[model samples]
Target: MPDSTPRAPVLQMPQVVVDMKLPQIRELATQLRFAPEEGRIWMDERRMVLVHSDTFADLREELLASLGYEMTRGLLTRIYFAAGQRDAASVLKRLGPGASLKEVLNTGGRMHALQGYLLPEHVGRGLAAGDLRSDDYYGEALWKDSLEDEAHVARHGVGQHAVCWNAVGYCSGYLSYCAQRTIVVREVECRASGGNHCKIVAQPAAQWDNVEEDLRFLLPQPVGRRARIVAPVADGGPTTALAQSAVTDSRDDDRAAPRSLAETAFVGASTAFSVLRHKIDRVAPTQATVLLLGESGVGKSLIARQVHRRSQRAQAQLIEVNCAAIPEALVESELFGVERGAFSGASQARAGRFEAAHGGTLFLDEVATLSPTTQGKLLRVLQSGALERLGSNQTRVTDVRVIAATNEDLKQAVRQGRFREDLYFRLNVFPVVVPPLRERRDDIPLLVQALLQRFAPLHGRGHVGITSRALQALIHHDWPGNIRELENVIERAVIMLHEGEMLDLQHLSYADDTLSTPSYFGLDDTGQLMINTDYDFGASQSPASTSAASPAALDMNRLADDLLRQGPGQLAAMERALVRSAVRQAGGNITRAAALLGLSRAQTEYRYRKQQSAPG
Candidate 1:
């Protein structure tokens, strides 16, 4: 049964305030840089491109004809939404500490106007004055001469429905980023819809009456089945909303109550993350087993959780197991339950992960490490949904969806006979590759903000901020260890900072200036990666004297004389001393010390051991 009664609109526009009167907004024009010599325009570190209104209108018409109206709107909305998120990250980084929430939100509006999208004027009480998480909180704005609506109406006749989809999406994205929650913005009145001016309303997504209907244009079409919004009963715990299907549904009251901000939300707005998100949305509804392939510490566990959260089984248990952490002999007992007296230490019957995860999901990380015997049992359970307990002939049945993840190549393992081919196919029903952090450098700023916000509160450090130079260094680094490495670096930097102190290059472990590969790469105003060529490599020379005049500053003749003054065995002693010094400087890490000394880890260890055993 649907609620057929009509409800009043959530917002009504009040007297509009002039944009110039707003005192909270930062001047965005200063951040805008132009370099005609290099033929580039930049807004902070982001590259900006200029597209004519007619050209955009042409593309919109083509997309509307080809993919249809709803999809075109959704596609354009998502693009601007990502743009808004990137802008939020830039503002957060540049604002430093002690910035009010009002200032941030106002700056976002000003930024939208600066980009030639719309001249936004705040109507009704502004968003910053109220608590964003409150149920009654609502925001309204008037867009004077919206570029989207003006171009849309010029290309095609005035439409019945509001046509400013990009403006709605950009507002939603910008507000959501600043709030750290999902905010939905709708163009209630548009010039294309015969309105004198465009009027937009915004509120948290969960507060909307028909959230599913509002979000339909943003996601891809589902393969099968109508969309359903499942709102779990929360016992003082977290809750998530089910995203609507790609196609629209005519049903009423398809509502979900999504929580404010959660730590589990996907934080990155980069294209790589967007593609990965689309793949997850497509596969989450199905009961097919998902194989998450990625390098270690690439957030596979988080992806597994995301899949479960978005699936029909969100309310059920999600059992996670690190296959590599468990010993080979105990792997079977852990995955499948053991009956009483099943083994020497078996005292009582117990349910395995599959039983625990009945009507839910089972995330098996490092799944390639399972032995042949265990792999065979896993195959049987996956195929027939039945398993036999250890030391027992009785069979048990459990309904569970499995999502397996691994850094190793399963196909290569199958070819080498390390993993079963049958089991591999069973789990590989939907493979999603999570890209490494280095491939998505645009996400670093957002990730940094999220990490800092999460870490600062835990350590009781109020308002810990980072320098722009330090953040730039982070964006340039090659994160071989992926997100995990980034987390370690940020956490270490946070720990080094004093209470209320800002994080600088000195606090970063990897950003030390003395290192050979210093964190000196930065993006110029033209958005080009520029190396800090001005860094002085000549350290041993006197500060007041030039290297040309001080030829003996690093003279090998003096070193040879010193060696000659010592005994014949001085060379070996010097070599041992250098290895020891490198190891000490590397904080006892033999691998890093080996890198410092330009030797293999084994070679470094051998030399270190020989020197240690030979007398002081």
Candidate 2:
């Protein structure tokens, strides 16, 4: 159930203090490009160019004039949300993984100050009632030369409501990036509104009062001006902008827009994906046994790695074992290790997966494949954190977190007596269902861009991209193979693609889905027949068209000549197509199709299923 009670703010009306330790601020250089992580300010030869505050102020005025208030606010909010996320990430990146949360927050605040958005005077720390990490952060800023505020004041002279739309977005984006949750910031008082300074309150999604209003600012919207795709730099570094991908639907709600938190792996924006990621992060820190359930290409292994990366045992190695790949007889020895001189060919004692994964994670892919004896042993290990070597009687203690994955239904297996009911209950303590690629279609654009970036260089193809139409086709197609299938398609295209060519429809090849609907093939009296290539393949003719031209009257020599000209592969393809056409015309009745094809019923059914079973 969702938490119903309102979560109190981490710090409300925090007291300003002196001697608050701040990170070493980097000196301003010629080029002030935002880092890819968005957490730090760095300088690169081919880096981000710094702009004067006046430039931002001018842009704000122009946007307001052309796009109106809400639209302008939405645009600027998205822009700064990205900037803030980068800035927060930059802070964390520079500080390293060991840096304290306070350091990260403070450094992020200081970076915004240096960027001339506002001077952060004070910040609030500590956790709220349900705060998972030290994520709920609050701070106050003195609006000194604030671009949005200054722009608003110049145009409408101190209005009733606050005018720091950009700043609010920046704060929300930065904090949200830091917390990995939706954090909205609102300006209760502002300098442009005749207030002394800007006072803002920040909290989680359910904690804030005007959350709907603030959250609206962080939503995504299309730009009125023509957009361009920013190619990677000469060094092959990718752009960090959220809106840089292909054209998006105007109806895309901000609440449902891409999060742009895609790390080295795993990317998506749909609600199904968002929930899956949240569940992973929530369970990663603990030593809970996780059972990942999904279809074969749903990226369960990747999720397991994510869990291990975030777990307390991250410093240790993550040992993986494919239960189905191992021979049934060797499953126990592989998992429990073997002792020297204990069995035939047991020359030396060796540690098994559980021992190797001590103090870390053990990923058992396709756990349902374990035999009854192996399953009993696994249960014994789970019940007691001890295991005996295959050839030895000594029981050694092992500390390991088990994360099991499978494409099959374990509950059904248990009911059928194939799997242990106790093991299912134990592993199902944290059940996560990884959504297939088809379910998260909104993520295709980003996935395509990411796949190209990662694969192009490896195949010697320079930075590449996809056309809009090709991307739309990819989004509409139901990916039965999921991410793995998409990656395979992209990689194959990359191999054949030219140095700088973009991947369009011509490069993408899908299995044949077109099924011919016809009973038989025949010729007309005039040796010409009608069939629409668009609607009809002329795949096969009907009895009405064939009755006049009997088989005895046809030219056998010409038929043999045609078959000889086409190779075996082509002949096979033609035969399969004809078989499919017959089956379809017969309404999928095997005996009827066999009669039409002059073949046995078993032969007809086998061929039809085989042709239909091929990937499409």
Candidate 3:
């Protein structure tokens, strides 16, 4: 069932005069530089006047002319009985006869009372009476953080720096009056919840500002003890009923969040997986260049395929080009194609990656390694959608989508002049960063099962599954080479597995020696000394030693042997200990620990969190 809810209203203040008898109050407001046109005063339920307050000085003269009042500056407290609303007498009377003038000036409590008057029953009846327009009831809630600072000055006099809260309150109140509805103004601190710095919320004033000037023209001239009803006025205004119905229909169309491609296509429910899939969907349909960034062996090519599969041009072929694998001199011809007899190597006409991918996509792997000349040609294709074949003057126009991948930082390459800025911007229109296997560690078991199923059938061997302990080890290991490394390890393990056996840690190919060593302490996997700690020379050690073994030597040989036989759980524990020690020494500085261990900050942090969350 579709939901139905009334939206809030937008409000606008009108320019009008404020009747003031006291010259001193007017003088004070003028000295404060408040403009009169921005605020109005109500006198004895019969007269309405405008006053100039310095805060809105731009509208001061206009406000005076509108009210047919002389533009003069003076104190106004004694002269102005009430500001805003032709029905002020009844509003003030409801506040009680003995209410102090100060109580009336206290806007917060009065504002709350006004909200109470907007009860659903009252609003419904008002709508029925044609006195209240439904269009005046709905508007988007806008919050400005700076309102509190402004309010503080309005409530309390601005000392050195003049703050205008009166102007704010007057403007907000007049807007509500024009809308014939209550408006709530909330002054909220910007940084209170570690969100925005400040926010001022104005609510339920619906389109008030949009039609306020028209409302002012339609307002009846003041008469003694009663608000004179003027003739119905229309500034060629559209019917409010239509607006109300549209708002109602729009509410039905609202959704909490958008559905992802994985959710809609494969019925996948994992949020992380769905987010990645959604990113692919958004980037697929457009010709905008996409940069796919992920660690090595993280199925970047698989993601590229998914993008191509979901794209409109999926009927066309998707060509893959590994930039790093191609010779620097031949990279341009490979991408842009070459004419027959263009060069010594070009014996026949050959369509390049771009031509082959016409009406489809060209996937460039390791794009950061492209030669500067290749980068320039790629930029031209992206900019002009036209390419020149090698040794040919004719330009071929190709409608091809581009998807580039790199594990390295292209931005850094651009800064170093290794990558062209124009090409980088063109190709980096949308960037999809594929998370490493370690990030989506929960998927490790699924991947392992799939790999085992595939490899077992290929080898003509019985199907095998990983034991819980072995799986734990696989999840904990820092997959430097990512999925490719995992696949190799699983394949090797499957090859070595015996019949009727669930694979255990011993069956796995990874051992203590295979793991990277800790360079900071000069420690290997088995606590063997790879560096001499006896060197007292205080100098920055080589980056290579950051992952080496500690200099201390003990039962190092036995420890290494034990680690080799033990499962990944044991190795993970040792790694955690090393990380914790480094973090403690660095005073919880993860970056320093990462530098000490020759690991990236993200890698160090991930490992730390994994250890922290592991079951005791």
Q: In terms of TM-score, which candidate is strongest?
A: 1
Candidate 3 lDDT over residue span 249-362, tens digit each:
111112213323221122121245556767877887776688898888887887887788778887999899999999988998899889999999899988888998888888
On lDDT, the candidate that comes out on top is: 1
Q: Rank the candidates by lDDT, best first.
A: 1, 2, 3
In candidate 3 the C-alpha lDDT for residue 281 amounts to: 73
What clash pairs does model 1 have?
A: none
Candidates by TM-score, descending order: 1, 2, 3
lDDT of each: 0.69, 0.64, 0.50
User: Taking the tens digit of each residue's C-alpha lDDT, what string does model 1 give over 131-213?
Assistant: 76676668888877678787777777687988888888788767766675667888888888888778888888778888777
User: In angstroms, how far off is 177's CA in candidate 3?
Assistant: 63
Error of 1 at 137 (Å): 26
- lDDT value for candidate 2? 0.64
Q: Which stretches of candidate 3 lie over 4 Å from their true place?
A: 1-272, 511-616
TM-score of 2: 0.46
Pick out the ten consecutive residues of candidate 2 with the lowest summed lDDT: 228-237
- Residue 389 Cα positional deviation in candidate 1, in Å, after optimal superposition: 1.1
RMSD of 2: 24.1
